[model samples]
Target: MIQDVLVLGSGSAGLIAAVSLKIKIPRLNVRIVRDPALGVIGVGEGTTPNFVGHLFDYLRISRRHFYELAEPTWKLGIRFEWGPRGRFDYTFSPQMDLQWGDLPRPNGYFCDDEFSNVDLPAALMREGKAFARQANGAPDIQPWHAFHMENEKLVSTLEKVAMEAGVEIVDGKVTGAERAEAGIAAVMLEDGRRLEADFFVDASGFRSELLGKALEEPFDSFGKTLFCDRAVVGGWERGEEPILPYTTAQTMDAGWCWQIEHERHINRGYVYCSELTSDDEAVEEFRRKNPKVPESPRVVKFRSGCYRRMWVDNVVAIGNSGGFVEPLEATALMVVCGHTRTMVDFLLQTELEPTPSMIALYNEQASKNWHEIRDFLGLHYQLNTVEQTPFWKRCREETDLSGIQDLLEFYRENGPTGFCRYRMPSNLSDFGVEGYLVMLVGNKAPHNKPHRVTPEEKAIWERHRTANIAKAKQGIDVKESLYYVRHPGWQWNDEIQAKRG
Candidate 1:
């Protein structure tokens, strides 16, 4: 029987895993060991629609409280600046019934019937609106909303929740682990303290302290495909234009830049390949681009890849320690949260037999999920038409990759890159048809189709799209909606305090 678990790290993954386990089995002894020396990547703030039920409900984290502590502004969706030139907003759509089935196309292109109301968010934004608007009196659509939090806020919030739930939080670095023939027998901290547990979770970011050191699973690099390994991040106060309810991911010559909103200041970053651009150059270019609302940003470096095995023997790695893809799409948190949720489910529900077969299945599932996310992130680079610098050109022509060729070919014909679309079961259920359309059609990727459709179906789709757009527009006043949330009295800005109350 599993009596105790030692979670090694304090990032989202480590905290989430601990909370999930505590919520599942209250009596299980769960402890989080965090080292003050190791810094969190601290850049993953954007989230997907999955935050609603998967993360909030599972962690027993109050959604409203989370928003308040994180000083979170609602994220309708991401605005991608493709080719370093054009911008397109992929927002939450309202259209219904998008499924994976044989669809018909008129021009030998695989045409999915799931393209309705995909532009609703963009259209609303064009008219100055927030997608997930929470007003006092009016009935809200409650569309997909995720938080744009200071990563530190998220960690602190989760730490409080996990601690209150009876999980121990220890501040110390793990120096070594004594291993037996079975697996790790006990972990020794830098203070010369020994802690023994039945299971160990390696959430120690890229270091992979417990797993990497004990299991010795070599890390597999994605340097060949992903060029950007370093990032410089900083914050700026909301300017006179008012805080935008959406996150902007602007493509640059070497990499991409992200603009996220917090309560006091807007968090911004320029992610680029260190091999291509120096830190000083990136800083100068950022200053030149934005002359207003200025603050110096800090630089952080990283490798884009994961350990060959996320879990081996008695230990399982999560977050950056397990693997990391580019933050082009702000997928860092989504991947980590998704994996931790799955891991929790496995631990709570499935009995730990310690059999070779059981371990193999767990490893296989984790590896497949991680690789799928990596390939999907790689798609943003591989399918680009940008040739601005050696980075973009190399991305467009980068070979020696695996897994995504099928997805790319299918998209070239079917419309939409099907990269890592099947990782989570809830993705399809929550997103619906409009969601798929935004990714497939908005990105200018379609499939070769031969399914013939009658004029009746075509007319029906057009009519539905027009009607949905009209209704979404009428639901709320765009400018007024933004004003409503930005109001300080709304009490959504104090993320930490909200949770305590």
Candidate 2:
């Protein structure tokens, strides 16, 4: 019999692992332990597509219910505001199943505007429409919408689910562990109770207690590639207007600001460097700009990096403990979800092959995934238009290109990178090539030799553009759709205008 599996945290990753494993293998008893002092960063206010399908759908959850429970607002995608005042929204594509390109050609460009293909997704979003038509003309969507929720509420919700699934929750701090010839024999709790488990997961966030500190796993930092390690966060009430279905990322002098809507109010945060400004200075800066901000937001400092080894012996690390990129697109939950899912998949599919071999495989894949997400995030800074301060200059002139230099070079020569749809287990294009191209071209990332389409291709594109423009004009208004959802009983009746609330 497999001894109890101990999960060493209570954040999203820990909850996900506990719930997913219990659902997959009913026989194994799973328990989660967290230091009552160590609260889950109740600040991960955003989620990804997997939150809907993998967690909600498989777990038989109602979207409406989650909205009500967690006080969540739907996130369509991120609206990136950069440079002097450039702006564009990355709309969630509804018809993702329509493969853009075939195998040999393997690329389908999606740029139709001067600013990062913003026109296409923007047009679709404005029309309250989707990209392609399904059989019935209804939007056949992939699980794409992210969630903006109170982190505490989300954790509490998941904890309830874990309990319902027969997983036990233990509260306390872990003092240390007993290591044996083979692997970790048991975990020692602060209260002196020794808990034994065949397998362990550390979701302890930043404090890689089990894996990093105890097991001595190596960690690699990415502070050189990305900056803005500090952030200030606070919440506000949702005003009278219906909530917009997107998050706003606005570039500032020091770094950037994020605005996400939740059921109660809008959650706002500014991420920047502590080196340039102090906490008091940042607060003063924020006050000068928004004079309307009623209360002060809290300060949070973080490091951009990941573990060199995610799994060692019988232990695995997930979530913030493994690594984190700055929250440009809210990849925190998604990355954690990916790591948790990967761990579960690996454990279910394969037995514990020698510890070193298994760790090597996990490390290799984790590194690739980290770099893929890192490069994508770095693209924002690499192709920025902020020249206000040395911060912006560094973003533009930063030499640590990693894999983004090649992408920039390719887009500079070709038109754009094609749409990215690489799911886990298959690293096709983690960050769609087309999306990157649109941004580079939109931002005008200095290209020595830009690719020019042939006259024939240009003509074809012009014609298509003309037709698409007309269609876009005929699309439904997004704001109107949000209104309808807010008041679901509204209808245009036979006799007169009827409104039900």
Candidate 3:
């Protein structure tokens, strides 16, 4: 039977794949081939709530170890500083969908002017606080929100966890591939050992060692829709600056700057189009904006797209090796978590060797997932009109939002009502109608004829917003909350932990 798996690279993708498979199939031999010379991207990475759910629930990694090693801080939502509305939050929970007490329409139609306080989490994000506090105000348990992490530490933490699971970690690099009829038969290492396995997972980041270079998979670029390709990244030691609980995405001269929060340091990066802004100019602008950044920022070059097929025979490319989009919405690791989970389940369900139809189905689902991530991020650019710079102006004027055209038209007509739910796909969609609705309402997109709310409905909306604000005021900032959780007296509610899994 198929009992062994060789996973390339030791990044989060490879380690998670190895660990999950070993956990799922107890007798399987899983070994990770990594190159010691190459280093991880080491930038700030963020995850969606699904990732949080998967790690502790599906994969069952220890939360205590994760907190201790990853140095994670809470992220309820992203505070977007873009478009006409200036600053708004796309929270984990549905912001506008909770129709308050039989209102004539959803509250979004009335939130065109001031919208952030519609949901409790969004309001909490606005005030730089986290958690929904319980009575007596001891920092309550963390919510089902995501996390902001140092990417390098995240990978290392996962690697340690994999080691605990009996996954063999080896130091090696792929020099060549020994091809066979349906797929790769064996991978040749630089040291001349040929490692063979029933399945191979290519998680080699941009190098894409097995799938891209070895299998020679054709790439489909999202260049038409998502254009930014480079990031000027840097951070400084955190001293006395207040540690906020949300990621800050601020619009800049040419592109945008992302400020990711951490316990002892704050990471910042400028993602911009190289066509409109040069490396030197981007770096200059980055320093101009973030004066506190100590050393010169490093630049990371990347493309926006995926392989034509995520699964090809015995090899499946996960993470950046498969495809990538700009860092908008913090999709990288979330995508990694999802594809890894799907891949492991599929492998086990198929009796360890995937059939042609299985591979085809996986490809179809993965392709749709990649494109949806593109369209969702594209939705962000299509409606943004905040900065008047060449990059932002060109984005508003030229970006191809054809993928989400029908969804956009529906929202424009219906105005964030729960009526258009059937239009979006239930599977392979990263964020459902909830994500789109938040971005749409937050940007104050125009509708030809808006829903009129009665005085009674308006009163209810105001009361909801007021209640959210009061609850947020009772909550504490990120550092204080994390310290509370790390205390010796801290104990997770048994009921909550059981449901979390």
Candidate 4:
């Protein structure tokens, strides 16, 4: 009977794990240990719709209260400045996957010449709108949109939520672990105190103290697929800039730069390969691009990979302790939510005694999740034709497309067909076929079989796009949406909250 669970570390991962367990299974004892000396890698973070669902739907956190605490801006999607065109928007909504009622082909087929205004969210992104306006002049908030938040505010909010959920918060630095036959028996703290639990969760970030150090779990690196290792991150206060509804991913000489927007700040990071560009060179390039930055940006180094198995013996690894790609898609929190949710589900399904098969299944799914993300990110580099720099030249020549070779082959032979979904893994990523098609078609990756549309079809597509553009223009900005939500008389719709289990 796994009654007590101890989570190591106090970042977003550890707090999320502790709170989730405590909330889902109130009978179980959940405690999280933190080293007060450690600080979070505070960079602006963007989230997918999955993170929103996990927080509001699964965790049952009050939306109104969350807004008051975690001051986040709305994100429609990402605006990529890569590929041949100036830019293209990839929204959370299903743009390329679904076909219009009158059209015979999927939306991707019509996006070859012009990629914008394919869906409402994409149009909203282009128009700098966060949400559609309702009849009463309120923001029509939907489930498909995401958020852009500062790391400190997000972590602080999670800590408060965890404390409220009956999770014990202990401040201690782990010195050593006592080895049991199957797993860790207890962890020794710096204060000369020992703590034990029936199960252990490693959320110790890249250190991976429990799973990687003590257990000596073998790591599978994604170096062949993801080459950019270091990121130079910095930000500036928002002065007169309009709060854009989408994150901007711009191409750089060595790698790429990401612009994550907050209500009052704009955070940027240049992710580059050290082999092609030195730290000084990268900083120079970053500063040349954005001169608004006041101070010298700090560099953060990381490897891209996951362990052989997330669950081993009685311990499971979550968040960066398990694996990490780059922040290209802002998948850090999304992955954390997924891992924690899966762990809680397994515990409940097995009635606290997880069988060997259950553990095996958990590890299998975890590996698939990491690999799918790796493959998806690989497509971005493999298909990008934006820059001809030494780094991009090497990427085009050597980037591994083995995992997504079949998908690419099918796409080249037949342009963005819905049938391509059959070629993907059974447990497809959140990106799904929509994401692949968006990247492929958006980048102008040539397909042999091009769909030549007739004049009538072209006119119909134009009409649809114009309608979307009109709606997007009528939508409200994040500032206006915030005003409505923060209003004293405003009420949140309970449709999503009502469906929570």
Candidate of highest TM-score = 4
* Predicted candidate 2 versus true structure: per-residue lDDT over 125-208, tens digit per residue: 444443323354333333556667778898988888788889999998888988866557788998899999988888888787
Q: Can you write out model 4's per-residue Cα lDDT over 64-164, one digit (the tens) per residue? A: 77888999899888999999977899999988888989987888888878999988888888889998899989998998888999988988999999999
TM-score of 3: 0.96
> How close to the true structure is residue 357 of candidate 1, measured as C-alpha lDDT?
64
**Which residue segments of model 4 deviate by more than 4 Å?**
495-501
Provide the clash count, candidate 1. 20
RMSD of each candidate? 5.4, 6.3, 1.9, 1.6
Task: Assess each prediction's global lDDT (C-alpha) against the native.
Answer: 0.66, 0.66, 0.83, 0.89
Model 4 per-residue lDDT at 468: 93
- Put down candidate 1 lDDT per residue, 1-501, tens digits, no spaces: 778899988888898878877887777799999776776667788877676456555665665555455555666677777632355666654322243233333211223433324346655544445553334544253645666678888888778778878999989988888996766878999889999999888888877887777778898887877778888777676655555657888777678888886656777788898888898888777666665435577888898877887778788888888888777666667767677766766765566444566667667776766565565556666656755688777777873346656444554554433332442222312343344444445455545643455676566556645655665566455345545655665543235575687
Estimate, for each residue in 270-344, the C-alpha lDDT of model 3 and write its tens digit: 999999999999999999889998557899999999999999988999889999999889998888888888887
Candidate with the greatest lDDT versus the true structure: 4
Clashing pairs in 2: 127-476, 238-265, 417-433, 417-434, 418-433, 418-434, 420-432
Q: Which residue segments of model 2 deviate by more than 4 Å?
A: 57-68, 94-113, 116-121, 124-142, 351-356, 417-430, 448-501
lDDT of 3 at 102: 59
**Superior candidate under TM-score, 3 versus 4:** 4
Give lDDT: candidate 3, residue 480: 77
